[model samples]
Target: MLSPEDVQKVATLARLKLSTEELQQVSRQLDGILDYVAVLNEVDVSNVEPMAHVADVANAFREDEVRASLPREESLSNAPKTDGKYFLVPQILETA
Candidate 1:
């Protein structure tokens, strides 16, 4: 349980400006959330095993195979700008 003053302190740290009504509302909401978390903590799981995933899963791999690629000349021929073997771009750095 958090006091109203504690909620105010949290609001101040967050740089949030809340009215008196909003402060009260937020304080109640925060307390409710804390209470719900406390209930969750009361659950017994001593015999339960932790699992990495909820559903059964396995790696689906495909057979490795060689494939042909588009010709380099055809790939770069439509470029707005190119530097022979690669694409060219405007300078990113500013001159001093």
Candidate 2:
């Protein structure tokens, strides 16, 4: 359970400017959320094993193989500008 003062401090840290009414509302809502978490903390889980994933899954993969690719000249021919083998574009920044 958080005090109203504690809620106000949190609001300040979060850069939120809440009116008195809104502060009260937010304090109550945060208290409710904390109570729910407290309830969850009381659950028994002694027999449960921790796991990263819930499903029983196996790795599915495909073999890597080389495939034919278009010739460099043909590929760059459609570009608006190119530097022989690669596409060219304007510089993003000026050197100092």
Which residues of candidate 2, in runs, are more than 4 Å off?
Answer: 43-96
Tens digit of lDDT per residue, candidate 1, span 1-96?
Answer: 788899999999999999999999999999998988888687898998988787766777888898888788888999999976988899999999
Clashing pairs in 1: none
Best by TM-score: 2
User: What TM-score does each of the candidates earn?
Assistant: 0.42, 0.43
lDDT of 1 at 91: 90
Clashes of each: 0, 0
lDDT of each: 0.90, 0.89
- Residue 53's C-alpha lDDT in candidate 2? 85
Write one digit per residue (lDDT tens) for candidate 2, span 2-86. 8889988999999999999999999999988888888867889899897878677878687888888999989998999998877
Best by lDDT: 1
